[model samples]
Target: MEIHFTKMNGAGNDFVVIDNRSGIYDDLTKEQIERLCDRHRGVGADGMLAIEQPVEGSSSQYRFRYYNADGGEAEMCGNGARCFARFARNLTTEFEDEISFDTIAGPLVATFPGEDVCIDMSDPFDIESDIELSLSGTPQTVHFMNTGVPHVVLPVADVTAVDIVAVGRELRFHEHFAPAGTNANIHHVIENGHIRLRTYERGVEGETLACGTGVVANALVHHQLTGAASPIAVDVQGGDTLKVEFEKDADGNYRNVKLIGPADFVFDGTISI
Candidate 1:
């Protein structure tokens, strides 16, 4: 089969996006997806996004499906959602300034303000602070949260000095978050509401330019640790800056979380599979 696809990126975290609304690509196998995302052999990307028709009775404009570079389906992807929004807006006439879509995590709304795409993310849960874990045979304190997916944030003195892949891999598979595992991130607070971050994505199984959920995870963790205000600016490894905004509820939980960043169109092409 020949597939027409668009390439997009959010803060340098790239993806291969396709319109699967008619279900033409429904039978796409995991191997095929992996091949599509192979940097050496295919249209290199951090993950894949599919724009599908929303489920019956749902009010969303569409459904978002994400597959990691390893070809595993995930609950949600913050960057992918932004790219999906822009892709959908460019492809469909139904969308104007904003659009809503459904995912395994829940429904999400995306808006375009200037060149940036802002996503109203779902409420975060399962937060744990000051957890001690052994990393490289040394005890370390880390924070955990589920922003659509599980993430472990380690505050480091210098993000550039850490062996992200090596330490992140250990943290990703750590027994504390075993079975499902989790994404790993190391961040250094630049100031009260700004930080530099690097992430080891779970399904990608390596360091990428950036990880959307990982950015939000780090931002919220920073707030919990330092009482930083909303609208945190995060400098990602991709050389791009993304913003995360959230409000603390009466219960001290995070709500109205938003991930804002650029979703750019790289190119469009057709390839036979």
Candidate 2:
């Protein structure tokens, strides 16, 4: 079987975007998806995005189905969402700078305000603070929240020195977020409205240049602790900057969340399975 695809990146987190509207690519085996994301054997991407037909009563132009490099289905990917929007726009003549898409998480509205595609993300829920975690026989206070997917933020002094692949994997598999593991983020505060972040994603099972949802989680957690405002400037491992904006009410509940970042086309090609 031959399939067409576009390689795209948002802040260095890359994805293989496929237009599966015909529904023929819907039943790809997990092994096939995993192979497609294999760096040595396949196209080499952090994940794959399948553009499928919209669900019943969905106002989105299409539905975005994402799979991790490990071939597991995910509810959403912040960076991939931007790439998906751009791919949809390029194929959708009616869409200008904005597009909406449906996902397992829910409907998302994306707008290409300028060079960046800003996505209106769903509200962050299941927020818990200072949860104790055993890190190498030492106690660590990690904050938890679900931004589309579950995440645990551990404030660190230097993100560069942290063995994300090791510590992150330990936390990712911790019993606290068990059964379905959580993504781990090493967060450092630059100041109010600014921070540096590194994430160990669940599906990818390692740290990428950037993690959109992780950045959002970083900003929200910062705000919750420091009483900072919206539009936080976040510096990611990919050396790319992403902006996170949200409105938090009196009770610390966040709403109107938006993740703004770059989504660029790397190339387009087809491959045989």
Candidate 3:
């Protein structure tokens, strides 16, 4: 089969996006997807995004399906969602400034403002703070949250000083979060409402240039720790900054969470599989 796809990136985390609404690419296997994401052998991306028909009874314009480089389906991906919105808009005339899509996480609404795309993220839950873990015989302090996906955020003194792969891998498969592992992140607060972060993503199984949900996870954890306000600026390894905004209710629940960042088109091509 020859598949037509668009290559896109949000911040620096990239993807291979296909319009699957026609059901043309429905039979793509996990192995095939893994090959497609292979850096040297295939299209080379952090993951893949499929724009499919919305489920029955869903009012969304389309359905969003995300696959990690390993070809495993994920609940959500913040950066990928932004790129999905842009890719979907350009493919059809039915959408303009705003678009809505359904994902494993839930229905998400997105808007395009100039060159950036902003997504209304699902409300986060299952928050745990100051959890102590023993890594390499050293006690580490981390926070946990479910921002569409499970994540563990470690506030480090210097993000660059940490061994992302080694430490992140350890935390990713730690028995503390067994079975369904968690993405691991090490972040440093740059200022009152700004932070620098490096993440070892779960399905990607290694470090990527950026991660959308990881960014939001760290931002919210920062707010929880220091009482920082909304609209936190996060500097990712990709050399781009993403902004996260959320409102805290009187009961300390986070709502209206939004992720704003750049979604750029890299290229488009047809590949044989």
Instruction: Give TM-scores for every candidate, taking all chains together and pairing residue i with residue i.
Output: 0.99, 0.98, 0.99
Residue lDDT tens for model 1, 52-108: 999999999999999999999999999999999999998767788889999999999
Per candidate, the number of residue pairs that clash is 0, 0, 0
lDDT value, residue 132 of candidate 3: 95
Cα shift from native, residue 162, model 3 (Å): 0.9
Q: 1-273 in candidate 3: lDDT tens per residue?
A: 888999999999999999999899999999889988999999999999999999999999999999999999899999999999999899788789899999999999999988899999999988999999999899989999999999999999998888999999999999999999999999999999999999999988999999999999999999999888889999999999999999999998999999999999999999997
Give the number of the best model, judged by lDDT: 3
Off by over 4 Å in 1: none
Better of 1 and 2 by lDDT: 1
What local lDDT score does residue 45 receive in model 2, on the 0 to 100 scale?
96
Model 1 residue 54 distance off true place after TM-score fit, in angstroms: 0.1
Off by over 4 Å in 3: none
Model 3 gets an lDDT of 0.95
Model 2, span 131-172: residue lDDT tens:
998899999999999999999999998888889999999999
Q: Candidate 3: give the clashing pairs.
A: none
